[model samples]
Every structure is written in C-alpha cells, then in structure tokens.
Target chain A: MALLEVKGLSINFGGLHAVDDFSIKIEKGELYGLIGPNGAGKTTFFNLITGVYKPTSGTILLDGKDITGKNTIQINKAGIARTFQNIRLFKELSVLDNVKAGLHNRYKYSTAEGIFRLPRFFKTEKAMDEEALRLLKVFDLDDEASVKASNLPYGKQRKLEIARALATKPKLLLLDEPAAGMNPHETAELMETIRFVRDNFDMTILLIEHDMSLVSVVCEKLSVLNFGQLLCEGETSTVLSNPEVITAYLGE
Target chain B: MKTKSKLIKPYTKKSFITYALLIAVFTIVQLILNFGKMSFMMQSLLVPLCVYSILAVSLNLTVGILGELSLGQAGFMCIGAYSGALFSSLMKEAIPEAMVRFPIAILLGGLCAALFGVLIGIPVLRLRGDYLAIVTLAFGEIIKNICASLYLGKDAEGFHLSIKSAADMNMAPDGKMIINGALGLNGTPKDSNFTVAFIILLITVIIAYNFVYSRTGRAVMSIRDNRIAAESVGLNITKYKLITFGLTAFLAGVAGVIYSHNFSTLQASKFDYNMSILILVFVVLGGIGSIRGSVIAAVVLTLIPELLRETIGNYRMLFYAVILIAMMLVTSNSKLKGRITAYTNKLKGLIKKEKKGEIK
Candidate 1:
C-alpha cells in the first residue's frame, strides 16, 4: 500500500478552480518529484497537500488514515513536515532557536513547571537544545547557531529551513522549490544533502521544483502538473521525455 | 578542545557576574527606597507605577511575545478588582483580623481574573491582529458598562441601596454594605503598599522572563514572526496564543486587585478604554519584546506625569498626550529604524566572526 494517497483532489477559489481533480500516490521511502512550468498549479497542489488550503472535494489519506481539511499544525503533528518555496525562517530568532521552535510540539512540561524552573523543565529544554544543535550540525549550520536567521547567507538560510523541518521528526518531508535561487555548486550540494538526509533519516521526500536539472538528478520518480491537472507520471527519465511534458515546457 | 573551551569560558563567568550584580543592586535600591516617609500623593503615584508595570509586562507577553494585539486587559482587571474587593469585604467580619484577609482576597481576585481571562481568551484569541484587538476593546468597554450597573450591597430597608450612598445613609454598623454603580465602592481596606505592589511586580517579571525564555516562549515568538511557518512545524498557534492571552489577563487582574485595595475604593471608570490604551502605549514605548524596556517605560511614564502635576496642574493629561505622540513619532521613525539596521549589522559581524573561529 502507498504511504500517501490523494484521490480526486479539487480546490476552488470562488469562481476559479485552482487545483482540479489532482491525484497522486507514493509508496513508503520513495523519493518523488513534482515539476511544472510557472502558473501551472504546482504550488497550489502543495498547499492543498500540506493543509494550507482544504480541498473543495477529495480525500487525502496518509498511511491509510484520512487527514483531509485538517489544520496545518494538525497535519504536521501527524508526521508530515514541509518547507516553503521562499525561506520562512523566524528572522528575529537565533538559528538554534528557529530549529527549537519546531521541537515545541514534543515538549511535555507544563507552564507551571516552566515558570518555576522545575528540574523536569530544564531536562526537557536541554534535550531540545541538544537535538536542535545536532540537526544544525548535520546541515553544517552549528557554527552560526547563535546568529539571527536573517543574517545567514542565502544558501545557508535555505539549508536552515530544511534543518528546522527535520527537527519536527517528520516521516514524510515536502520541499517547495528548495533550490529556487542558488548557484550550480550550491544546488549540486543541496541535491546531495537532500539524498543524504532521506537515506540517513529514513524519510520519504516529495519535492516541487522549477529547476528541471536538480529534480531530474535527485528524484527517482517524477510527476508533471499543468493547469491544475496531472500531465504525466513515471520514472524521472521516462516522464521528462514525454511529449506532453515537453510541450508544456516549450509552450510556457 | 580549544574551541569548546573558548565557547564555554566567557558565558559562565559573564553570566554569573551579571546575575550577581543585578541582584545586589536591586536589593540595595529596594532597601533605600523603603526608608522614606512619602506623602499620600507620592505613594499613590508609586503604587500605580508598580501596578502599571505588571499590566504592561503582561500585555507585552500577548502583544510582543505572541505577536497578537489585545485590548481586554482593563476588562480582566475590572473582574479582578471587583471580585477581590467583594471577597475581602465578605471575609472581614469572618476573618479574625484585617491582615489575615488581605492575602486571601488578593489570591481570590487573581484567580477570578484568570477564569475570565480563559473564558474571553478562548473566543477572542481565534482572531488575529486588529480583529483580536477590536474584539478585546469592545469586551473591555462592555465589562466597564456592566460593572457600572451592578449594585452588590444593600441598605437598612432591605431595598438594594447604591453602594456610593450606603455610607451616607444611616445604617447599623454591622449591616453596612458598599458597591454602587458609577458611584464607586468606598471604604475598602487600603492595605496595598509599595512593598506589596513591588513584590507582586517582581514575581510577575520573574515568571514572564522564565516563560519567554522557555520552549513555549520560543513557540510564541515564532508565531509572532510568521504564523504559517510556526503552524507548519506543528506548533498549535491558537492554543499558544490563548495561553498567552490568559496569562496576560491573569497578571492584569492582579494589578487590578492591587489598585482597588490600595485606593480603598473600586471605580469602574478606572478600567476603561483610556486605561487599556495607556497600557498599550507603555508596551509600545518600551521595545515590545524587551522586558527591561516595559518596566523602565512604566516607571518613566508614571513618574513623568506626576513630576509635571504641580506645574501643569489639571493640564497634566495634555502634557502626557504630547509626550506620547512625540515618542511614538521618534521611535517609529528614527530610533527603531536605526536600531534595526544596527542590530542587523551586528548579526552579520557575529556570523563572520563565528565563521573565522570555525576555520581555526
């Protein structure tokens, strides 16, 4: 059985159908990709899947449990985590604290315990800090952990977002345009890092990318979306070479 | 090994000295201030200053830490002050002494306020930004109007006499009851002092500081920074926002209790739109997220109008308005803009330094 299945998902914004009858299924531990030209409803699909927008009609099942129309936080707590196309780090917070914010859901100490500085509060806080540092180190961001997230270089900021998502301990991770703005070298490094995280953490990844080269190199399977419809789906090389996929890119 | 030592060494010594010095100075100044025999006016002003500090700091937890605007503090305070006054009055004859009833009254007042906080927060917290502020402001006005119509105590004829006129009317000493609409409840025990107010203020600051520094605090800050991003990581935005609202209201309620007990009267007019705005100004005038800023602003704003009282006389409010407008302009334009740029530059420099250190 597939780890995630979206069946006949459709969403509308008043008169316009933003995402129409989209469906996709992924097996456990698979690395999948979604690619489309600009204005092709790629992001709208991601938004629907991540619960930023509830579908007007359809069902989203994760590991055989329906999770449609739930709030974004609820979806996240159910073991799905995502990064934005634009990096959305807490700009005013320190790098480590941004990662720690993701660990907030796991905290067990009550407000009373925290206010009184109970030993249990301290223990949990220490563990969170250590876990945040460990994630940052994996992304090579530990050296800049104390600095404000906004001050990090663009590449490092992108990596920090991934690290924060990881801190949520998600079983399935979604990346929205993870390599939107990057030099070739940075993009190549991010590709390897993405692969490394998936293998090391044993996580399933679903990604959206406009950069065909990066998506083609990293994703074993790819789906093509156009005008809120699925254009094609297959192995990366087969789907990329499809005539409809070629026509969509060329027309745009 | 060398890198670890370099990282760990300065934090330990610097933090230890900083904490020790702060404690010593605070204690010493508190001692010196306690020795003075102040006039009634001075005491009244000082008491309000401490009370406002608690209100401003608590409101900041919601507005600054949680990144939501709220205007229902005065409503919560009204709940606290009225409830506290009622509790103390009821227990005065029952309790052996006035002193014994004081602490119980204050606690009861705070708890009552907290209950209202949770009640109002559950619904109001669902809205964000200006929506929440508007709902809260309306709630505050509604509370004040409701309190204005309540007649809690009675007269000799058994007809519910207005609390304001109860003292003037002839009544048995044991049968005297107070609390009237718009007339203000009179003859409440005046037990609130600078020491008591400051102790509560101290406890509030300590609790607020711990909350903002904890994991829950970070979650609140993140929600303030970006609600969508915070929720995407599984932080329950609504739940945390309500928590902050409830906690802030609880503190404001405590301030209300202190105010009522100190003045020996409870006036519904004191908890109105003007008071809520005044507290908001305190939080904004101080850097919103800065605890020290709120405390300092509370003290300065409180003392400034008082210092001008004799000179400006009844026009003290005009002076306050002028200063508030001037500070708002300065802080919004040059001061905060400059600070932001400076802070960004400092963060960049720190990053570079860390990179260099890592290279070594």
Candidate 2:
C-alpha cells in the first residue's frame, strides 16, 4: 500500500481550476519530485497536499486515513509537513525559537503551567530546546541557533526553514523550491542534506524544484504538471525525457 | 580579534549593575514622593501613571505578542471598575467595617472583566490586525453607550432603581437620569491605594513576563512573525490569539477597577474611544514587544501631561499629541535602529560571557 494517495484531487479557485484531476501514489520512503513550467499548478498541488488549500473534490488519504480538508495544523499533527516556496522564517525570533515553534503541538505543558513557570514548564521547555538544537545541529546550523533568523544569509535561511519543518517530526516532508536561489555548489549541498534528512528521520520526501538538475539528481520518481493537470508520472529520467514534458517546457 | 571584544564588551557585569542602579533610582524617587505630604494633584497623577502602566503592558500582550491590535481596553476596564465598585459598595453593609474589601473587590472585578474578555475574544479574535482593532473599537463604543444608559444609583426619594427600570422613567426636571446619566456613577467607595496599585502592577508585569517567555508565548510570537508558518507547524492561531486577547483584557480590567475605586466616581465618558486611544499611545510609544518600554511609556506619558499642565494648561493636549507623534516617528524611523542593535548586541555579549564563566 502507498504511504500517501491522492485520488481524483481537484481544487478550484472561484472560476479558475488551479489543480484538476491530480492523482498520485507514493510508497513508503520514496523520494519523489513534482515539477512543471510556470503556471502549471505545481505549487498548488503542494498547497492542496499540505492542507493549505482544500481540494474542490477528491480524497487525500495518508496511510489509508482520509485527511481531506483538514486544517493545516491538523494535517501537521497527522505527520505531514511542508516548507514554503518563499522562506517564511520568523524573522525576529532566534533560530532556536523558530525551530521550537514547530514542536508547539507536541508540548506537554499546560497554559497554567507555563504562566506559573512550574517545574513541568521548565522540563518541557528544556526538552523542546534540546530537540530544536539537535535539528539545528543536523542542518549544521547549531552555531547560528542563537542568532535572529532574519540576520542569517539567504542559504542558511532556506536551511533553517527545513530544520523548522523537521522539528515537527514529520513522517512525510515536502520541500517547495528548496534550491530556488542557491548557487550550484549550495544546490549540491542541499541535495545531500535532503537525502540525509530523509534517511536520518526515516521519512519519505516530496519536493518541488525548478532546478531540473537537482530534481534529476535527488528524486527517484517524478510527476510533471501542466496547466493544472498531470502530464506524466514515472521514473525521473523517463518522465523528464517524455515528449509532453519537453513540449510543455519548450512551449512555455 | 576586535570583533570578539565588540561582541563581549557591552554585556559585562556592568550591564546588570546599571539595571540595579536604575531600579534603585526609581525606588528612591518613589520613596521621596510618597514620604512628602504630597498634594492631591500629585497623588492623582501618580495613581494614573501606575494604573496606565498595567493597562499598557496588558494591551501589549494582544498588540505586540499576538499581533492583534485591540482598542477595547477601556471597555474591559469599565467592566472591572463597575464590578469592583458594586462589589465593594454592596459589601459595605455586610463585611466588618475595619476589614479591607477593596482588594477582594478589585480581584472580583478582574475576574468579571476576564469573563467579558472571553466573550468578546471569541468572535473578535477570529479577525486579524486592523479588522480586530475596528471591531474592538466598536465594542468599546457600544460598552460606553450601554453604560451611559445604565442607571445604578438612588432616585430623588432615596429609592434604588434597576438601570433598566430607571431608563423607562421620564427624565427629571433637571434632565438628569434621576440616576446619573453622563453625570457618572457616584458614592462608590474610594478604596484604591498606591500600595494596591503598585502590587497589581508588579503582578501584571510578572504575569506578562512569564507569558512572553513561555512556550505558548513563543507560539504567539511565532504567529505574530508569520501566521502561515506557525499554522503550518501545527500552532493553532485562533486559540493562541484568543488566549492572548482574553489575558490582556483581564489585566486591563484589573487596571480599570483600580482607576474606578481610586476616584470613587465612574462615568461612561471616562471609558470612551479617547481612553482606548490613550492606552494605545502608551503601548506604541513604549515600543512594540517590549514590556519594560510599555511600562515606562505609560508612566512617562501619564506624568508628562500633568507636568505640562501649569505651562500649557488646556493646550497641554496639543503638546501631548506632538510628543506622542514625535516618539512614534522617532521609534519607527531608522534613527533608533542603531540603539536597538546596540542593545541586542550588548545582551548577546552578556549571555556569552555568562556561559564562559559557567564553563570555568
């Protein structure tokens, strides 16, 4: 059985069909890529999957549990997490705090305990801090954890977003444009980090990348979208070399 | 090499020593003022300063931490003041004459206000930013209008009437509600003292500090920073925002109770839009997300008008507006960015030095 299954998923923004008849199934621990030309509903597909946008019609089943239209927080609690296309770090917060925010759902301290600064509050806070630091260290960002997230360089900021998502302890991680602005060297590093995170966390990853090279290098499987419809899906080399995908890119 | 010194220089033990010295100065000033046979006017000014400090800090919880602007602080305060006044007045007949009922009444007022906070927060907190501010402002106006229509005092014949029944009666020859409309609620016991006000202010600061430093506080700040990111990470924006709004309203209500009891008089007009704006001015002038700044702004703004009263007289309001606008502009401008950077750098330095000392 697939770890995630999207059956006949469609999303309409008023009169515009943003994503139409999208369906995909991913087995456990698979690294998959969703790619397309601009205005092809690639990001929209990610949004729908992450519960940012509900589908107009269809079912989204994670491990056979229907999670369609669940709020983002609920979806996150159900072990699916996604980074944004644009880095959305809490700019004014310390890097550690930004990662700690991802663990908010798992906190054991009650509001009363927090307000009173009880022993439980301290213990939970310490645990959260340790977890956040551990995630930062994995991303090689532990040294910068005390710094404000906004003050970090662009590449580190992107890495921080992934670290924050990882802090949620997601079973399935979605990366949106993880290499959008990175130099080739940085892109190479990020490709390795993605694999490291997936293997270390024992999770599956689905990433949206405009860098076809990075996608080709990291993703074992690929799905191509065109104008809100699935154009093709198969192994990365076969899907990228498909006539339809080549036509969609060349035409655009 | 120079970079390390630059990073480590500012946050030395001297930084803490300066804070302690500042605290000492404040205590000394407070002592000098309290010891002297201060005029009633001076006492009134100090009371408002203390009360407004609590109001500003509490309001910051919603405005700064939760990233929602609220303009109904005065409304909550009115609720607290009225509740406190009513509770104390009613208890006068039952409680021992020597026992202090003001503290209990203030607490009850805070509780009542907090209850109102929950009610108001449920619907209003669903809205964001400017929408939340507008709704809260409308709520404040509605509360004032309700209070204006409420009749809670004795009639000419010394007979007490329910506010609703009193409203149904024709206006007396003097155009008064026969129950004090616009004239204000009178005969409330003046039980708010400086000690009680300061104690409440201290508690408010402590609670706010604890909240801003907690996991939930971080979540609220995270929401403030990026609601989408926070939501994506499983943080419930609505729940945290409501909690913040309710908590702020409760504290505002406590301040209101203190204000009402101290004056021994209450007027619907006192809790109007202007009062809410005044509280906002305190929060904004202090610096958003800075509790100490809010408290200082509250005290300074409260005292500034009074200090200018003799020189500016009725024109004092114009001067106050000018000062507030100047402060806002200055704080928001790039000029203060240097100071803020300096402060943060100093703090970072101090933390590093402390860690190094502990390592040794």
Candidate 3:
C-alpha cells in the first residue's frame, strides 16, 4: 500500500481555486518531487496534505486510512511531518531544545512531574536529550547544540528545521523549498542530505523545489504543477522534456 | 562526545545561581534582624519585597515566557486573597494552629486563582496582543467591583452571602461578619512573616525556572515564537497556553495570600489595575523572559521609592520616575543592551578566573 494517497483534492480561497483536483500516490521509501511555477499552489498543496487548509472536496489516505479534513496536529500524529518554505525554528530555544520539542509526543511525562522534579521527569528528559542529540548528530548540528536557533547561520538553520521534522518520526516527510536561498555549493549539499535522509531513515520524501539541478539529481518521480493544476507526472527526465511542462516553465 | 557529568545544563546552572542569590539575601536579612540594628521602616519592607518579587516572576511567565500581555494579574490576586482569607476565617476555630492552616490557605488561594485562570483563559486566550490586554484590564476592574460590595456572614443557621450592604445579609445578631460590603474581609489571621514569605519566593523562582526548562515549557515557548509552526509540529497550542496561564495565575494568587495575611484587613481595592501595572513594570525593567532579572528588578524597584522617601523627601516619586525611564532606555535600546551584556560577560569571566586561582 502507498504511504500517502490523495484523490480529488480541491480547495478554494473564496473564488480562486488555490489547489484544484490534486491527486497523487507516494509509496513508502520513494523520493517524490512536486515542482511548479511561482504561485502554482505547491506550498498550498503541502498545506492541504498536512491539514493546514481544509480541502473543499477530497480524500487523503495515509496507508489506506482516510485522514481528510483533520487538523495539523492530528495529521502529524497520523504520520505526516513537514518543513516550511521560510524556515521556522523556535528562535528563543537552544538547538537541542528545538529537536526535543519535536520529540514531545514520543516521550511521556506529565506536566506535574516536570514541575515537581519527579523521577519520571528526569528519566524521560534524559532519554529525550539523548534522542535529540542523535538527530542533531545526523545533521552534524551536535557541536552547536546549545546555540539559540535564531543565532545559527542560514544553511545550518535549514538543516536544523529538517532535523526537527525528522525527530517527529513521521512516515511521510514534506520539504517545501528546502533549497530556496542556497548558492550552488549549499544546494549540492542539501541534495545529498535529502537522499541521505531518505536512505538512512527509510523516509518517504515529497519535496517542492524550483532548483532543477537538485530536483533531477534527487527525485525519481516528478509531478509538475501549473495554474493550480497538475501539468504532468512521470519519471524525472521524461517529465522534464514534456512539451506542456516546458511551456509551463518557459512560457511558449 | 562530552561526558554527562562534565556538561552542566545551562538552565540548571542558571537556576542554581538564582537559588543561591535568594539564600544569600535571606541570610543577610535574618542576620540584620538578629545581630545588627534595622530600622522599623526597613523591617516593614521585608514581606512586601518578597510579595512584589513573586508577583513580578509570575507576571513574567505570562508576559515573557508565554509572550502574552496580561493585565488581569491583580484580578487573580483578588480572587486568591478573598478566597484564602475566607477559608482562614471559617476554619480559624476548626484548625486553630496557624502553621498548618496558613499553608492550606495559601494553596487554596493559588488553586482558586488557577480555576479562574482556566475559565478566563478559555475565552481570553483566543484573543491576541492588544485585544487580550484590554479584555484582561476589564476583567480586573470587574473582579474588583464585584468584591467591593460583597458581604459574607456565618451564624448558627449557616453561611449567608449578599452583594448589597451587610444589612442585606440579615444574619442573626450572634453571627460574625466575615466580609463587610466595601470594607472587604476583616481580621484575617496574621500568619505571614518574612521567613515564610522568603521561602515562598524561593519556591516561586524554582517553579518558574523548572517550568521554563521542561518539555511543556518548550511547547509554550515555541507557540510564543511561532503559533502556526508550533501547531504543525503537533503540539497542542491551546493546552500549553492554558497550562502556562493557569500556573502564572496560581503564583500570583500565592503572592495574594502573602499580601492578605501580612495585614489584619484584606481589601479588594488594594489589588487594583495600578498593582497589575506596577508588576508589569518590574517584568519590563528586569528584561523579558528573564526570571533572575525579574527578581532583582522587583527587589530594587520596590525598595527604591520607599528608601528615597526618607532621603529625598517629597521628590522621591520624581526620582523614581526618572529611574524608570532610564531603565527602559537601557533595556530597550539594542546598543545599550549589547554593551551591558558584554560588560556582564566580562565580569563573569573575571569571577570564574578569580575562583579558579583561589582554589589553586
């Protein structure tokens, strides 16, 4: 069974159809890509799948379980995790705490236990810290574990966001413009990280990227979106050469 | 990888320093009270110093940690003071020991205020920023006005409550008037002292620090930073907000109990909008999201006006206003704040070096 299956997904912000009739199936451990022109509803589609926006008409099934119209938190608990286009980190928190916050639901201790310095609080906190550090080590952010999130360099901040998302232990991961503001060297690094995440964590990744170099190198299957509609879907090289996808990009 | 024993968590170390500071102050006060001469004026300022410090720290939890502006702190304190005083008055005979009864009263006060926190938070937490501030301001006024005209009395028959004058209660002549209209609760036992207040203040600091370091605290701070991102991460934003709001109110209520027991009469009029604003001033001057700063600022600011009253005579308030403006300028200006941080870091380095040399 596919990890994520969206069928007849549609949403309208007043009169404008922000995402219209978007449907796709992503199997477990597959690297899927969603590419689109500016304002072509790529992020909005991510928002829909992650339950940021309620679909006007649709069904989103995660491993054959219908998850349509659930809120963001429930969807995350249902095994879908995502990162934002503009990086969102807990700015006031340390790098370690940022990942630990994502590990919140996994580790169990009551608020009262936390406040009272109970034995369970110490045990769970120790476990959480170790797990958070492990995730940070995977992203090579362990050395700067105590640095505030806002103080990190741009490239590290992007990596930290991904690390935090991974800490949630989701089956399906969505990356929105992961290489948005990177130069060629950093984009190269991010491509390797994306593949490394998919391989090491056995993650099913669905990412939106405008960087074709990173896209073609990383994504096995690609879906092109234009004017809030799916323009084409196929193997990466085949869809890149399609006439409609070309016109959607180059404006023939 | 660094060994766990070698690495001290930054928050844990910082909180230990706060506890040490509190202990040092407590020692100095007790020493002066016993061995050295202390003016009557200075003696009276002791309990108030602890109370204001507690209020400031609790308010900081809302304004600093939770990043929500709350003007209803005084309202919560009012609820705590009245409820706690009422309990003490009713149970005066049943539990005659001041030691046992006062602690229960303090807890009761805190719980009463926390109950109000949840109820008010349900609707108020939905509103953000300036709207939340205004609504909370109104809430304080509403609580004060409600308590002002409230009358409670107990007789052989039972307890009677009336919002009108004391006469409207129509209690039997043998009954005792616990709360008189506009006069507030009278003859509340004076169980609060400087030592108990100091202990409570220390506990408040510990709770505030612990709450900031915990997983639940992390969720609350994340919501403060970015609500949508926090929601996307599967943190229940509402639950965390309510927990923080309730805890903040609970601490404020604990402060109210201290305030009520320090005097024979507990008046709702004392817990006014100005009182809430005064505590906010402490939080702002200390530095937002800074627990240690709140405690230090509360102590310094509370003592300044009173200390200046004898030294500067009628010009004391004018001097206090000047200090307030100066502190605001220093804390808010990025350049000044950076310079202050740099100087403090340098000072800390020197202290560490000196301690190492002494040990050697």
Model 3 residue B19 CA deviation in Å: 0.6
Q: Highest DockQ among the candidates is held by which one?
A: 3
The TM-scores, one per candidate, come to 0.88, 0.89, 0.97
Clashes of 1: 0
User: TM-score winner among the candidates?
Assistant: 3
Query: Compared with the true structure, what per-residue lDDT tens digits does model 3 show for residues B217-261?
Result: 889999999888888789999999999999999999999998899
Alpha-carbon runs more than 4 Å astray in model 2:
B1-26, B33-37, B97-100, B153-161, B164-181, B312-315, B335-360
- DockQ score of each predicted structure, in the order shown: 0.52, 0.53, 0.69
Residue lDDT tens for model 2, A1-252: 898999999999888888999999998999999999998898898889888887899999998889999989989999899898899989888888899888887776877798887999878977887787788889899887778899999999999999999888888899999999899998999988999987889989999889988999999999998889999999999998888899998874
State in Å the error of residue B256, model 1. Answer: 0.7
**Once all C-alphas are superposed, what RMSD does model 3 give against the true structure?**
2.0
User: Which candidate leads in lDDT?
Assistant: 3
Candidate 1 displacement at residue A50 in angstroms = 1.6
Interface RMSD of each: 2.4, 4.1, 1.6
True contacts kept of each: 0.70, 0.75, 0.66
| Candidate 3 ranges with C-alpha deviation above 4 Å | B1-8, B339-360
Evaluate model 2: give its lDDT.
0.83
Q: TM-score of chain A, model 1?
A: 0.97
